[model samples]
Target: MSTDNKVPEIRSKGFSGEWAEEILGDVAEIKTGPFGSTLHAKAYVEDGHAIITTEHFKSGELPVDKKNIPQVSEDDYLRLKAYLLKVGDIVFSRVGSVDINALVTNKQEGWLFSGRVLRVRSGKIIDSEYLHHELSTSRVKKSVVSRAVGQTMPSINTEILKITPIHFPLDTTEQTTIGNYFQKIDALINQHQQKHDNLSNIKKAMLEKMFPKQGETIPEIRFKGFSGEWKNLTLGDLGSVAMNKRIFKHQTTISGEIPFFKIGTFGKQADAFISKNLFDEYKAKYPYPVAGDLLLSASGSIGRVVEYKGEEQYFQDSNIVWLKHDGKIDNAFLKVFYSMVKWSGLEGSTIQRLYNKNILDTEISTPERQEQTAIGNYFQKLDNLINQHQQQITKLNNIKQACLSKMFV
Candidate 1:
């Protein structure tokens, strides 16, 4: 497992970092996508030929969902079959979310291409998978992002794509080996991602059952013989929303401290992370969220809720609202309630704007303090399990990436 051994370093140029040249155009025949109306999907029919587009490509592989393959008549296939996709053909997104790449794996014989994507076919000098990996690397991604020309939605044309420089091993066998290795890694990452998604669904189901419905006083399941009606309350009556006023100019030096979370960090479950430092010299200007404060994203990505676990060292000023609960209301209960509100579409602007006042006005039904504790504790355990699985998936993906970087070279 140790990657300590030094491997061969191949420069793009023939010389050692002095006369670097472009790897793509030299090794592949890059073709601009068809622009004429000859490739329209209306020409396709049921049981039609497979058609590829930017939408079909996801995370370096073709996604099965959202597939839009159209059936081309035998006559039409003759006119357009040249653009039909084959195994090993590398597809690249040329427009929105530019530079996304996918390798064709499904061997089913009839696949076509759309105008939004480009096909990169290799010459005798290069392997298709190797070139695909080169296009997908972080270095290449940066280059592609830089080379993309448009101001609003940047994109790279086929000509620019052909000249895009890529670094790779000179040996063909090594190239194929590296390509195949990363392919396996990509598959594993997708698998873990799917499992993570399933676990999340399970947690959501558990939450729905644990919490009472709107205006319902008693939960479907109660502890032992205990039974009590939950109370209805307005968020403003239970707690007050506080906005952070401080701002941080620099985020680079703030790493090991607490992360200041903007509304962007809020997710369906909790705030993704904490801020480490505050830029505003006035320390008390922004509301400080302690271990029990409920953090809600008040703007963009509305309705994300997270309980402060004392992990973040700091916070920032953005579209964020902090809810400090009164002693009568449990913080955990508030967290669950916020989650329920989000699920019910109660908070956030009437027009999708997220603000503190919108959340304050949200109506909530709450059980007694003891019952709230029980429900919160139940969901907390479930959330912990989901987090554990997520951590494992992260470790596995990191291992895959390391293997990719080392095995390729």
Candidate 2:
């Protein structure tokens, strides 16, 4: 990332020399979209030619589905033929996010772009895919931002884009290799993203159907070999609310032996810390949460839950609290139930805080321990898959960014 030269610091094996550079105007044809008056919103129809707005430009391939896209008549499509998008065209945002652009594929051919878009058609000397990747580099992005005008809303024009500088390998084979490499990475990222989204949707549907609705004794859906009605109980019947002993502001430090989590940092990284001695002393004297205990955020964002996991950490008292429960109810089952639990007195409250009384009085329905374990284990596995895919997506994105930084001049 620190390197800045005509050729990439990291590249495919063999055949390398300093890359060639030229203004975009010298290697491509730059054109702006049709004026707003030329294509009015009223001219749009239900089924016809699709238009490409800034909204349709995405990090992945353009969606082929025409469900929600606005369209125009055949006559209008021909009238704006100059603005028609072709395969391999690169479309850039003319205003905000002027640095982001989408490369046209076969899916987007024959579409018209809005006035807020700028199109770059590669000439015979340049490869469009290579140009797209080069434009995505941090160095070129910074250049575009530096030349952008307007304080409140940065904007770019055809003249500005035409003069933008880009560097690429002299060999077309090298350009294709780099472009295909990034394309495969993008495909993997998109695949994981799709799975993550699908699993999330399935989880949401299962949560609603697996749990009983109001005034019902049995859930709409349940595992076989479990027939009896579930028991109706209040949270107070299971446990009492407990919290850590109060730690004053002076007890905390920016960096120390153990992390101290406030309501804001309940499920995230801690910005404050306390000495190990203080943490140990406070934990011993207070009603501390055991491993697998569910910690709830009572203020700010009400009812947010996290498992303690037995980490060496302290949380803000009162604002964050947990239930000190007997061994009857399973923590795994309770964790999933928390997603569906509605705290009493939350409705029609002006302050929007979850008081201890509301949690104690909240109603719940539960089956026997064996059934509880079965249901909890099933959902937990699903959760594991979802988290694994999320982590993969994040890691792949990081790798892509690093490559983009070093693979280009």
Q: Clash totals for all models, in order?
A: 17, 0
After superposing candidate 1 on the true structure, give the runs of residues whose Cα lies further than 4 Å from its correct spot. 1-26, 32-36, 41-50, 65-79, 107-109, 123-125, 142-151, 204-230, 236-290, 297-304, 310-330, 342-360, 368-371, 385-409
TM-score of 1: 0.67
Tens-digit per-residue lDDT, 366-409, candidate 2: 99999898888988988999999999999999998899988987
Give per-residue CA lDDT, model 1, range 1-409, as digits (tens): 1224223333232322122235577877766556657666667666645666776665566755324554566777677767877777788888877767877766533576777888888777678887787677666777778889899987878887877877655567667776777777777777767777787897687667666765676666667655777777778777787766645455434343444455444433233333433333334555667777777765556667766676534544646667666566877767766766753343444436655566667777877788778777776776777787678778877886565454433
- Whole-model lDDT for model 2 versus the true structure? 0.87
Candidate No. with top lDDT: 2
TM-scores for candidates 1 onward, in order: 0.67, 0.89
Candidate 1, after superposition: displacement of residue 63 in Å? 0.4
What do the candidate models score in CA lDDT, each in turn?
A: 0.65, 0.87
* Residue 80 Cα positional deviation in candidate 2, in Å, after optimal superposition: 3.0
When superposed on Cα atoms, how far off is each prediction in RMSD?
7.2, 2.8
